[model samples]
Target: MAILTNARMPVETVNFHLWQPCNMKCRFCFATFRDVRGTVLPEGHLPRRDAERVVTLLADAGFTKITFAGGEPLLCPWIIDLIRLAKGLGLTTALVTNGSLIDSGTIRDLRGILDWVTVSVDSVRSGTLALIGRMTAARAADERHYLDLCDRLKDAGLRLKINTVVTAANHLEDLTGFIVAARPERWKIFEVLPVQGQNSGKVEPLLVTPGQFARFVARSRSVEAYGIRVVPEDNDAMIGSYAMVDPAGRFFDAIGNGYTYSEPILRVGVRQAVSQVTVSRRKFLARGGLY
Candidate 1:
């Protein structure tokens, strides 16, 4: 197939999802999952081939930056190999993960391959934890462990971006405290996206509307004061990154949705995928969106 990615808008960033299911069933996540069956890794569904094709596609599409994301990217088993491949291609690679996967081995493997890592930290206490559907039976220790990992990562000279998905369930009174607590070099804030399907009804009332989200942004300026660069999701400078690809070799739209193509690009080759990405991006941009 001859895919044509001939768009005028400078494509700069690309994001890929290593897996669809996540360990922490966060209330606001839209990514599909297999929570009911309690199987995080479905049978016969590994993304190796797809990720390989994605690297080639992004490289051809003029993408210099790439991000690997998932319900939890670290769960992909061969995440280190994927990062190495992306780095070998001269692409700055990033991992968007839940901090639960942080460990000495993971950190050691990422030492040179990854350019930046972003981990989700919703709240300080267990109450807020339940709000996100990730709870602690007793007093939680995972938060402390994650913080320690963050410190270690920083100490190892890795760039860290803390991702906070703001929802009504968050401790609004101590919102600033939460961001400051992470002490990340870069902090990215997001309006809680309502997750639909089996997890929908339980989380609907917790979401902040667009108007309320704007108000929250107005109130949380402490990230800047703390010397952390706050990258709000809606900012033009924070808009469409250099390039974004999915585990299935599908390019992502500016706001992180998959490209509108008839088939999964992973089934094809790099050149064809790039052509499709270019075509999809041009169509997406001309349509006009908050992204």
Candidate 2:
């Protein structure tokens, strides 16, 4: 129930979902809540001018770091431009991607504008990736391409982070090899979260028990010797910590069974939109969202 002491208290970070289109049909995507009965939803991204305005507004409002996320942020045509815009405003910019679309050309374009690039990799094993619906065919090739892309990003001088969703499907798979090879600055492990109208019913089988998650956490420690910092987040730890702006420019939070969104910032302004969502300062700091 603690509120930010001052309206001017700096926002350490903000995550924006630029669009809702994705190439991969991962079994446990929480963003599925935005889709209609197996139909592609309308593009939800703010127009380029509006997106730029929102970025400037947030930057001027004391947000220091901006992370561009999405159903797949790379699918956004203006993603690079947006990154450049954020960088121009002196905001630290980051991107969260599934890594399938990342190639030499993409990394080459992202070189200086992006400060951090976090790729999602659930497992090191090709079979597990296929079983988890991360890829349809050529899982081996996809995995290799992902690792190669990580190397290219590092070579580009961009900080790297890895995100792994520890589900029943791949919780037992040893990921130490990938951790060592990729050598990311951070490896974030998340427990499978079941949003009520999102992937809850369809992905119930993929949920891991608390004890199973603990085992996975213990096993993941093997990568520490390689200097990779592993950060774990269960549902409770993730819910209120994130400062999220949906594709429509509405602030939202996952504090309950489903997402609660604010009125669009374009209509109501950033301060009012932000006040509609709950942000946990303690949890945000604990997760290292601050610079």
For residue 110, model 1's alpha carbon misses the true position, in angstroms, by 1.1
- Local error of candidate 1 at 162, Å? 0.8
Residue 269 shift from truth in candidate 2, angstroms = 1.4
Q: Show where candidate 2 strays beyond 4 Å.
A: 9-11, 33-41, 136-142
The global Cα lDDT (0 to 1) of model 2 is: 0.81
- What lDDT does the true structure give each of the candidates? 0.62, 0.81
lDDT string, candidate 1, 1-291, tens digits: 223336422445556765775667777665443332243235323558656766766666566777788767887788899899989989888888877767888888899889888877776666677657764333333566666878888877789888777777862645566567767877767776543343466567677766666766667776788797766553233333323444444544333232233235556644455444333444334333112
Per-prediction TM-score, please? 0.77, 0.93
lDDT of 2 by residue, 223-270 (tens): 988888988888788888887887778788888768887877888877
